[model samples]
Target: MARNLDIALLRTFATVADQGSMTRASDILHLTQGAISQQIARLEALVGTALLLRHPRGLRLTPAGERFLGRIRPLIITNDEIWSEIERGDVSGPVRLGLPFDLVDSCFAASLKSYCEAFPKVELTLVCAASPDLLDMVGRGHLDLAVIERAVDSEGGEVLAIDRLVWVGARAGQAHKRSPLPISLVGETCVFRPAVSEALAEEKLASRMVFETGGLDATRIIVKMDLAISAWLASTVPADFDIISEDAGLPPLPSFAITLHRANGARGAIFDELARQLRNAMARPRLAA
Candidate 1:
């Protein structure tokens, strides 16, 4: 006599909302597109309201969908955690984590601390490096999981968030206004370097690399001192810096793909829990904005 919510349908709906497309959700869930649609429809019928709105570009969550997701996401996460703990049976093992150098001080710092506290018996090894290097480590089985940034449209891993790359400079810095814009960069292999260079070249703006380092801290110091302008994700930029825009005569930088790369054959409730926490870490509201 009373309708009951289905976990399967709720999962499908949540995946669609998180991914912004039923197609992507289907891929993640290993379900056919038609099946995904049917699940959504069934869920809607159970709730007696439409949960998704179709748009020309993709899908958007309706008002009801937003409310439903906010309430259910935590429940789903807690449920998963409970299962993981039960299946893990003491959950003691080594987990090698690879992260990009830029994210060390970001929200992930807190996430990592929380994870360590949650699984004190598990040995966690962290290696911070450039994205490409991190990806290689994960692929080679040297790391259990990694968070890397790639071109927005580039495909490969599970995307946690889409980040906007923007030109950054010190507050009140005129370094960007110079005829030959002074720039500082992280490393030769840094993903943002090529994009920044290409964008400047397209705008016919001459630029000089005044400083280059293999570390983010060095780059931060240079940019913070108003020595040079640099490009970084809007989310990762320090609060002390200012984001330069088109108004500053800089070409728009491309969006970046923030993704989770996991080693093959790495399955288990522990690994699943780690991935879930990593997703939560990277999906911070400020980062995704």
Candidate 2:
């Protein structure tokens, strides 16, 4: 037999159940109390039983209503989600993300632009930090997603983009100088530190870390002074910096992975979608460095 209940009534019932009162549901649905009562009455008649108990405090679900609520809550919710997805198929809201300062110059700007253009309601708040710190923040729920270098460990992250590491230095910095070198390095927990260290170890050149700090600005500052040399993305090299040529005996830099991670569920799906867009954007030839 065909069901005769109104979908609108079921929607109102679900909203009333969720909001806990007919008056509240009326306000939500912009209906009068009498109309709300009539809708509930119609639903009760169709189902051949009472769905709600009129209570002094508020409307409460009857035993039948309780069972019905449990059974249809997820279905209604899923329907709502699907309808919402159809209505605003475009993405929206505060997309809190973390990323290393270096990658911003590459895809972060243009890719995010495309994301925003495609979904104007999206508002992004970007947190810049070292790879390790970014990963930690993403893992802790402090950030929704992150573009991080390799996972710090097994529990680290998911690889989203990968690129080869490259060495850079001040155009006339120590790496380009003849005398003993002043090596500028990033602080601990940064991906560059290990990359630089391993490169030095392979060359059997025991270089000293004369400067250590976070953020590209700090590295660029010391390098601009020509007081020390640092390694970073070839593209991230400041205008005053140059790549340390292989003839200088610096070992070839290693490749690093850009990864993304999220908490395990709906939030994860959201982040995964963002990560996928980032990966696609980075894949564009223009962003490749």
Candidate 3:
């Protein structure tokens, strides 16, 4: 039984979701209240699940509805642009963008905001993961483009930025001076791991791996509590954390080249627009000592 979801029904459901009331959705869609209710019922029957709960407080999305909405909201955005916004001179379609976890805090976020404002009709999806994972997605055509990390001249993609790695710690923290210095490290697959660990080894520093994660927030929290010292791109280090000076006895870290990768199969004006934005934002002099 192959069937396509009715865009009309989806638009009705999404309208109600955004408005939070059947009456409000009916007003926007210019349909009678009974017609609105009937459309919602038809959609739920087709999906074989109750997508919403109608109560005195109005419509609240069920768990399934929440999941469905995240997937379909992009569809709705594209659809609305084709029907109503295309003539406005804005391109419309879904673009899957991937990047490493640390780059989110850099100037990339500001460029993303500007891109969205310039092309509101584009359905932009952001996927954050490790550099290797992001590169894999780009290779398999699961992402339109990705920003990844690699050695200075190694092939990850086209180099967009060069970021210096630095030892980070809580302000005035004792973790750096403690015997068997506590340190939080990223996953083994990370490009920085080998360089960071080897740097410490060459210095004969006795350190303990206190935690391992690919997440920025968790690493920041662990380091902020003075539980461990961690390494990060100088640009990604939080304001409160101090980059341990060389006099602090930590070995210097190597620099990583940030690069842009495009899906082999991806092509279109919208994709190019975003790629240009990221390149402009990142391909600048941002190295920190």
Candidate 4:
């Protein structure tokens, strides 16, 4: 009889597919490129087909490989969901989580601390990235749970909290309103981008991006320079930037729905517990930006 494919191989394949590159996948899996390659080769041999196309930039799944991936991903996730359910009483072992950077500073940090204290035996792992990246990670079962901005909606995660998104910058006296209106932005997947674009359009303002970065630190510095403005969670305001009122001819910005997702099934109970804690935290009366 042919040997069954190992879970490790499935995990390696999923990581490579998500990253689109063996090198990057290796970095994430904490395995050598050769090891990742070996796992893929074994999987391909067992399945008797080419699973990935080697390219200078990254790997792309063949049609068959893509189909195979689609079928297998749910299996992996379901397995975790089952395990999580059984382990609820135990709630032990490592729990890997993904989170957006802005949220780390805003509220999740405290939540994480509480979770650790409550489940002292459960090891915690964290992955910090943008909302889109966090969503993708959670969907693949690489993360047990993720706190992402509102945009990443799919079958895997559940909504945790709802919050408004808004634009902010220096007060009129301090605002420079530079020509071309220097604008700063995170990557395209940032939930705030569309809101910012719409707000500018409503005001009939044409702005050019002077700085675009993945890091929020750069956003803070650029906006502080008074040469640019950006959109962020209303709760993420740093105290220096003043919220630009919607009636000030700026388009109405959308609110964000914070979502929590875990692999479906028994393993999802921890996510439920964590989600409960998070919603309770947000319910308290708080200042908006």
Highest lDDT: which candidate? Answer: 1
TM-score of each: 0.87, 0.60, 0.66, 0.61
RMSD of each: 2.8, 17.6, 17.7, 13.1
What TM-score number comes out for model 4? 0.61
Tell me the tens digit of each residue's lDDT in model 3 across 235-276: 887777898998988888888888788887667678767876
State each model's CA lDDT, in order.
Answer: 0.82, 0.66, 0.78, 0.70
Question: Candidate 2: misplaced stretches above 4 Å?
Answer: 1-90, 151-158, 172-174, 178-180, 238-240, 265-273, 287-289
Determine which window of 10 residues in candidate 3 has minimal summed lDDT.
Answer: 80-89
- Candidate 4 error regions (>4 Å): 1-89, 151-157, 171-176, 265-269, 287-289
Question: What number of clashing residue pairs does each candidate have, in the order they appear?
Answer: 0, 0, 0, 5
Q: What is the clash tally of candidate 4? A: 5
In candidate 3, stretches whose alpha carbon ends up further than 4 angstroms from where it belongs are 1-90, 186-188, 283-289
Tens-digit lDDT track of model 2 for 1-289 = 8744456877778767755677767754679989998998888888889988878767788899988766665554445446445644545677788878778866567777755665567677789888778877766878887777762233345444446666666665565453455676667667777767776777677666667765567777777777777777654555656777878766787766566655443253344446646655553454232
Off by over 4 Å in 1: 1-4, 21-23, 30-35, 53-71, 81-89, 287-289
